[model samples]
Target: MTGGTGLFISFEGIDGSGKSTQARLLAEHLRSTGREVVLTREPGGSPGAEEIRALVLQGDPERWSAETELLLFTAARRDHLERTIRPALARGATVICDRFADSTRMYQGLSRGDLRGAVDTLHALMIGVEPDLTLLIDMDPEAALARAKARATAEERFEDFGLPLQQKMRAGFLALAAEFSGRFRIVDGNRAPEAVAQDVRAALQAQA
Candidate 1:
């Protein structure tokens, strides 16, 4: 965490795609190699953001609109950047986050409704920098949802989206990765988690 420009990396994927597991593994890999890493996630990484996370993911799904959801996500991101991301980066630590701006642009943006306006607004207002590297873990959303539902106590609002919509969402993620070339990596999430982590490591190493 000393003397160099900080690098910010973010992971994105459909639910049950195992990006969270891989993100932790990636953090450990970086740390073991003597890199200072801060692993965090959004709609989280801060107290206020955690509360927002519960509301966005676990609350009554039918009651909230697309705009409401987007605003809540950005609200959490603002806190996350100020409280955790900035400080860690200022120390030159590599910051890996579970989800960032891309998730909202995909899930709440393209999938739920037209969020082009919101995206533009937030892009202007956010930390004013994008991830140095973003991994959009690519997995079929149906497979992901099935895996998630099998392990769930109950369905959250997000899990209720049908398979067809989830597939569309997966397409949305692919489109995003295409929109940004080397800066984004799409990992095959259907593989074993460690195998996926290996791919992530390879991708990051190429950049370094």
Candidate 2:
């Protein structure tokens, strides 16, 4: 599937929404067709961003205040854009990012409602880039939360927020999709992985 120029695609959802899997599947599909694809994720993509990821994801849920956490996420994203995403796109590659600025908007905003404004302002001032296409993997929060719990990783910091927050995040994502309809595509994530992959493929193919 080709989109005229360098395509920047980001997959976003609450933890366990199966976005990561879809991102991988799409990357593989593109590579099989002879396209140069760069698959990446946030709050870790570049080496410096990955370091920042460890600090944010491995600590106690309350280790950093909401404001502090937002800063860290922003810093990581800046590093990721400068060191990883921008270069790949410059080389005319398709960059498939598992998560992007939207996560910070939803998570930070959902956790501390007042910080939503800060999130937006910081994004405009610091990050300043948006994906050409964003696939929002929509799903039932309870099911997704269960999937997140099953993983039991050290990065449980975000997953540890549990069901209620996941619900809020789902809403937050939908809201963002509405706000940025030009670049967002809401994809159902309740189906089998292959089915979901096909739907994602179809969505991009239509755009192409």
Candidate 3:
């Protein structure tokens, strides 16, 4: 639970599954209801972590080995927890994170290599926290990859890994949702944005 009065929420899905858009929409919805919402994203929430984001997100996909990427992501996550997430939670604000440790669990742990054990170990040793609710925006991997590639952003390292990786990630995320079913909610992302947002709200209400 965050060990705080505030609620912590995270969005997870394959690349371009609209999880980021849903995260923003949820934050806005919460703020409209006059709740204190701290909208944030992992790997770059705090200043120090933003620097790490640039290093790990850009460049070639093979720039760093899975082990190295895991270390870098863990460092950024620790900084983010200390500087951003914990403080926001302490102040009793709803924290809507675009992604969290689960992303690392998929990208570095399962997709890149069999490092799920190492990822969990580092998570326990350093950033010992998880969201109160995780909304997985489930969708078709080919469509998601197409949407991700359409962005043409510099942070396309993972997108560069292509559709097969996206398919693998989609399956991995669904498995993760099942593994953490107590706190995970699967939301279909193939509908219109407003419709998807409605489902997102429904999920949160269900959690509440």
TM-score of each: 0.93, 0.96, 0.99
Pairs in steric clash, model 1 = none
On residues 1-208, what C-alpha lDDT tens digit does candidate 3 reach at each position? 7798899999999999999999999999999999999999988899999999999999998999999999999999999999999999999999999999999999999999999999999999998899999999999999999999999999999999999999999999999999999999999999898999999999999999
Candidate 3 matches the true fold with a TM-score of 0.99
- What would the per-residue lDDT of candidate 2 be over residues 1-208, giving only the tens digit for each residue? 1233589999999889999999999999999999999999999999999999999998677888888889999999999999888888888999999999889988886654568889999999988888988999999999999998898889998787778889989998999999999889999999999999999999898777
lDDT of each: 0.84, 0.90, 0.96
lDDT of 1 by residue, 1-208 (tens): 1223799999998877888898999999989999999999987999999988888887565668888888888889889988888889888899999998888888778888898678768857764667889998889787898977776754367877758767887888888899987689888998989899999999998888
Q: Quick one: RMSD of model 3?
A: 0.5
TM-score of 2: 0.96
Candidate structures ordered by TM-score, highest first: 3, 2, 1
Of the candidates shown, which would achieve the greatest TM-score relative to the real structure?
3
Model 2 spans with C-alpha error above 4 angstroms: 1-5
